[model samples]
Target: MELGKIERLLDRYDEGETSIAEEKLLREYFLSEDVPEHLRSYQLMFRFSASQAEEKLENKPKVVSKRNWYSWTSIAAILIVALGIFFYNDSSRMLNDNGLGTISDEELALQKTKETLHMVAQIMNEGKSDLVYLKEFNNTKNKIIQID
Candidate 1:
């Protein structure tokens, strides 16, 4: 009978031996209200599976925020390089008229070196005097704080 064929199809379907046509027949039979009481569970299962197949994906395409920081950074780098080249060319063109790149006069260089050393020594002596004041301040702080 038709019921025996349906039972055989169900067994074949469960064993993964049913074709698409067989599955469609099974679906059609289970979806009908005339399904037997004994096979109600299969009908519910098929109905739920059918409903799941009808569901549409709720995934809406999201608009991601794009950043052009690389473009801006490249523009800034190009401007910096352009400015550097311009300044380098300008400075090279404007060399001092006095062909005095290096102090060719040894005596003048020695005099200049001595003057610079004297100025540095004077500043260092001033710093040493300030250190004396700092030591006095530290002594006064220790006395006021009473940290024996």
Candidate 2:
């Protein structure tokens, strides 16, 4: 009841020797309106602790159903997998239906002709590039092996 006793109890509390019930008692005493002037300094601290202990309607968190959460997640995963497979199969079918499918005899002949033309063009370009490099190399060698 006295501030000195309360101070001693608080000292014991600081040393971690006070029980939960003793702490509650201290909180109740401090929260009371008639708290002594000497103990007024601790009123806020005890009142805060007391208020913290009181359960409020808003304190409890909103609960979600685990079964529903799992069900939705599974459905989403299945939809993603199904969509991936559908798109992949559709693209494969599209590619086969287009000109990229296995060539017939006439298409094979046309493809060969196109390939031959491309090969000839590549060979001609490569020859021109090589000739340019060869000419530069010859000039460098001639400079290095300078004649009288």
Give each model a TM-score: 0.40, 0.49
Which structure among the candidates has the greatest TM-score? 2
* Candidate 1 positional error at 129, Å: 70
Error in Å for residue 87 of model 2: 0.8
Candidate 1: tens digits of C-alpha lDDT, residues 4-97: 9999999998899999999999999999999998889999999999999999879988755345767788899999999998877566566777
Q: Global CA lDDT of candidate 2, please?
A: 0.83
Model 2's TM-score against the true structure: 0.49
Residue-level lDDT tens digits of model 2 in 1-148: 8778788888888899999988877887787899777778788887776678785677778789999999999999999999998877556555645577456799888989899899999999987887988899999999889963
For all predictions, the C-alpha RMSD in Å is 15.8, 13.9
Q: Looking at model 1, which ten-residue stretch has the lowest summed lDDT?
A: 62-71
lDDT of each: 0.89, 0.83
